[model samples]
Structure formats: structure tokens, C-alpha cells
Target: MAQDRAQKNRPHYALASVDHALRLAVMLQVEGPLSVSDAAERLGVARSTAHRLLSMLVYRDFARQGEDRRYHAGPVISLTADSQSRTALLRTVALPHLHALVGRLGESANLLVLAGDYARFIGSVESSQALRVGNREGMVFPAHLTSGGKLILADLTPAEREELYAAQRWDGREGERPDPAALEQELAVVRDRGFAINKDRTETGVTAVGRGVRVGDRVGAAVTVSMPTVRFDESRLVDIVSALALASRDIEHDLQAALRVEA
Candidate 1:
């Protein structure tokens, strides 16, 4: 009864149309670009309503219509007084999707970005199982050893990759540095398959599948689902790959939008 009273006493004031319009603005800001139909589906509003809302946002300079006819976050949002860093923005935009992926696949999910010769985990959502991989945020792994890092590496041309490999300073550990020919072969598979997998590569008994997140034809980051080798099943690889691909699209959309806003 006291909880009911507390709930009733809580202040509430919201304008439905305005609230939805603001949400649409946020979606544009975080999810990159959207058409009226996409906004309608995401916002759960009628198409006409979504169109009206977008039009108003465009007028206010809070969103802009691109040459592709998709709606993008406008000057007002980018020029806002908020001092949030790009890294923070990326984490904010990616965390929810990572959580959703974890919920769907019952596996740990991560967002990683290329940092020099390493792939750095910037965000992670851990699985609920007792034996699952723990949080890896802020951790860095050699680019060649990690699925996410390999996907980013595969984005480079053969000559470019060769140049990078030649310039790399490797540790004395045996097999730490990848053979140029073998690495190129692996990259070819990654390109053809549109994803990369690491089985007992980064760590023994751990497996990870990763897909690159592209922003304007460049791989800016990667999204991955990781699990223990004991729990991993090759038969379910298709399902995991599909989930990672979907999440990658969402992240890429947000990344492209963010880059445009920054520009």
C-alpha cells in the first residue's frame, strides 16, 4: 500500500507528441540515419506522424535530410552544449544493443575498436551463466590473436597489410607474429565470410566470433560474441553469426551517424 502511495505521488508530466519527437531525435542521433518508415517502426508511431515529427525536427535544425533522403542528426544536436566525448557516445549507443544480443544468444557480447596494433574492448555485456567469460572492458589483445582485431585487419588491402606486418615489432613468443602468407589467406576467408572467428587463439578454451562495424567504407570497430570452447557448438555457428551480423549493422548505423555529427 505504501508503494502504491509512493508511485501515485511521483510527479508525471509528458506531452505525447513532443515526447515522441524528442525520442525520434535521439534515435537519429544515436542510430545514425533513418527513413520515415524506419522511424515509424522504431518509434511505434504512424507513418504520417513520424513524417511530421521528422519534418519539424528538420525545420528546427535538430535533424537534416541527407542526399540519400534519410534523416540524420542535424547541426543543433552536434552543436549542443553537451560535452560528452566520442568514446562515451559510442559506449552509450552500443551498450543497449550488446545487452540485447546477450539476452538473445545467452552469450557474452563485446564492442571492440582498433587501438594501434591491439583490439581494445570498450564495452561488454557478460553472460549470466556461472562459467561464462567475465567482463573484458578496457582489456587489450594482440590484433592478430583476437577475432575482432583480425576483422579490422582484413579491411586493409593486401599490400597495406603486408606493409603493416613488416613494420610491426613482435615479441619473442613463438607464433606470436602471423606469417604474411598465412595471414593473407585467413583474411581472404574473413572477407568472403564477412566475419572472423577465434578458437583457442586469444586464450585457450575460449572462442569468439566477430563482425566488423563499418562507417563510410572503413571498419571503425567490431562486435563479438564469445563463449567457452566447452560450451561452443559448431552447429550453432550460423545462428551466432547471424546475431552478430544484425548487431553489427545497428552499431555501424550509429557509428556512421556519430561520425557525421562530429564532422
Candidate 2:
């Protein structure tokens, strides 16, 4: 009897239904209100399957059906989108700088800021190289493991900095992650250096350099250039530093200008 019950429970783990429901929600999220046929076409599923998935989404507040019978992501998703919009505005202002840096350096340039306890990529520009390190916008990486993350985090107050690491995961390799006291010491060095360097901290072959974007006393964001370690040797350190500092100043000026326009 126990074996039979286990067999019955195994079917619940299939999750095909869950995948369809999530796809329906994402379709509604990106494409706005979608008819059953429209969603089915996007997901390459049968119309009946799409309708069933959307019904489940409605039950979970992930989507809603209007009087026109089109499904839209519900209020819960709208609130999240509103928050993302604020970040999107910052990314828009920083994109030109990021692109210019990538064009000049011939590497991947990323714009990042603190998001909760992690560093979130808000924008990125890549060189024309066939092989490159690319970043997905809005992807979050651990704060202690990236140059841009360290540059931004170093600007936070000591108390705020402690709060940031309280829940952080120290999954970095040996010697890369240290206790609270050690992190404080490292941050001090980063502050003095005016630029942060990550030597294979995030990935084995990736090296990155970053400078903070300061708006008056506060750091609004950071800009980073990521390249393969072989390409980022000490010979290029001076040039990288000069390029990043120039980019940082440009970003700060842009931020201040946007603030004036807003005011």
C-alpha cells in the first residue's frame, strides 16, 4: 500500500503543468494582455493547454482575464514592473557611457548597482569580438565576488555594509572569502585604491575592473569592464584604470544632469 501511494505521488512532480503556467504568465508579462490563441502561439502549445494554464495563473493572482477575455499579468506583477521601471530609467542614462567604454576598451562593459544584498546588472555593452563575456540585464551576482559589486559596496556606511553581508552567501573559493573583519580590511584597500579589481573572483578566467559613480556624497552605481585574465595582465593596468576613471566621471556628470532636469 505504501509503494502504491508513493507511485501516485510521483506524478505530481512532473511539473509540465507548472512550466506551461509560468510560460503563460511570462507571455502576458512581456506582451501585455494576450488572447488564448495568442499565448498558445507564443508558447507553441495548444489553445486548450494555454487556456488551462491561464486559468491556473488567474487563480494564483499571476494573471487576470479582462472583459475582452484576454489574459494580463495581474496587480502583483504590475507592482514588480513599476519597481523595475525605476531601475530601467537609470540604465537608460548609463547605456551610452557603457557602450562608449566597450567600444574604447574592446571588452564587455557593465553598469551595476546594489540590489538588496546582491549586485544587479542594470545595463551592459559588449565588444564586437566573436568571443566575449556577456551579461544579462537585471541578473544579480554575489556582492563579495565581483569588482563592480565591491566598488559599489565599499561606498556604503559601515553599519549599512554590515547589514548587506549579514545574509550574504560566501560561496567563493578558498582565500577569496573572509570573515567580517577581513572583508572590512579589504574594503578599506578598495576605498584607498579608487578602483576595484577582481582576479578570478567571480569565474576562473574572468578579471574585472570597476570604478564607482559618485553623485556628491553618495554612490549611485558602478561601471565595470570584464575581460579574460590573459587579456587583463598587469601591462594593461594603467590604461584600464585611466579608461575606467574617465567613464566614472562621465557617468556622474550624466546623473547630475538628469537630476537637474528632473528638478
Q: 1-263, model 2: which lDDT tens digit per residue?
A: 32122111123365867656765564455336789998787567899988888888888898999999888788766436654444555666788988888888899998887766567676777777776775534456667666888887788899987765653443443233336787788888999999899877656567888999885578767889988777778888888889899998887887778867867
TM-score to true structure, per model: 0.64, 0.68
Candidate 1 global lDDT: 0.79
RMSD, every candidate, angstroms: 14.7, 9.6
What is candidate 2's TM-score against the reference? 0.68
How many clashes in each candidate?
Answer: 0, 0
The residue pairs that clash in candidate 1, if any, are none
Q: What lDDT does each candidate get? A: 0.79, 0.73
Q: Model 1, 52-167: lDDT tens per residue?
A: 99999999998999999999889876523342255557777788889999999999999887766678787788999998986666567878778899999999777767766673
Top candidate, metric TM-score: 2
